[model samples]
Target: MEISFVRIDDRLIHGQVATIWTKTSKCNRIMACSDEVAKDDLRKTLLLQVAPPEIKAYVLTIDKAIDAYKNPKYDSFKTLFLFTNPKDVVRMVKAGVPIKSVNVGGMCYKEGKIQITSAVSVSEEDIDAFKTLNEKGIELELRQVASENKVSLMSRLDSLKLI
Candidate 1:
């Protein structure tokens, strides 16, 4: 499956994720690759329930997400892989996950973060990590809804002199 987006949303999956991202991307699957959420059956079930029946959901650890996505089993469906935080995306990229860019959706406003002038807040670590990706030609965008403009985290990092 072609991954239309690699998003960093701490909520993992929810209403806007189901209706907005899925509809906008026209994806057939939603994969929540989170270590904590993957182990919690209840939360997994809850997240899965929010999605339409056609859009399959998988809650997985970073390793499992890398392994599963690399395999041929899910090659037929278009995917939108969701990571709970920027650290996970950094880890995935460090672990050789096949992601070119990361989209920041929602995460609490944290201290020392350049908010990137978007709905999400990013930390100094995120700025550094995103800068690493940007240097590697991976774009980091911030957006809550599909219609909104994608704010480049790279530029924000530059503004903070983090890049």
Candidate 2:
């Protein structure tokens, strides 16, 4: 399977994704891997509906996504993986999904989370997961759109911690 892009955006299939990132990634399929989102039928339908017409999209559990990635039938798939949180991405990586990099996108501020970038915020668990990804040599970049320059998420986190 060719991983065209991997993004962590809380709003899994929003306007920016359906209109911008999908085209930028050049992926034929988009898999939103999140156990919580997978269980919500309404949310799944909404996400699937927003996907661009030419590209297929699936809201799947992390395990199901791993299975699909390993399945020979999907070997020709050029996939763009989407996640709502760093923990889910960590799960996919631990399950042997060969993700080389992750784009940290719009992670909106919520209670108990510290703002990392204007568009991103991190909880303690998120920080730990990000650190793990960094330690594993995976590139973690922050970019709201395809046109913007990529910023190192770890560097931003480190600078924030120092402040």
**Best lDDT goes to which candidate?**
2
The parts of candidate 2 lying over 4 Å away from their true place are none
TM-score: model 1 vs. ground truth: 0.88
Q: TM-scores for all candidates?
A: 0.88, 0.97
Q: Clashing residue pairs in candidate 2, if any? A: none
lDDT, candidate 2, at 28: 94
Q: For residues 1-163, what per-residue lDDT tens digits would candidate 1 score against the true structure? A: 5888888888888888888888887888888988999889999999988887778888989898878777887789788989878777877777776688788888777776556554677776766676677777788887877888878876766776766
User: Which pairs in model 1 have colliding backbones?
Assistant: none
Query: What is the per-residue lDDT of model 2 for residues 13-47, given as tens digits with 9 covering 90 to 100?
Result: 98999999988989999999999999999999999
Among the numbered candidates, top TM-score falls to 2
Q: Model 2: what TM-score?
A: 0.97
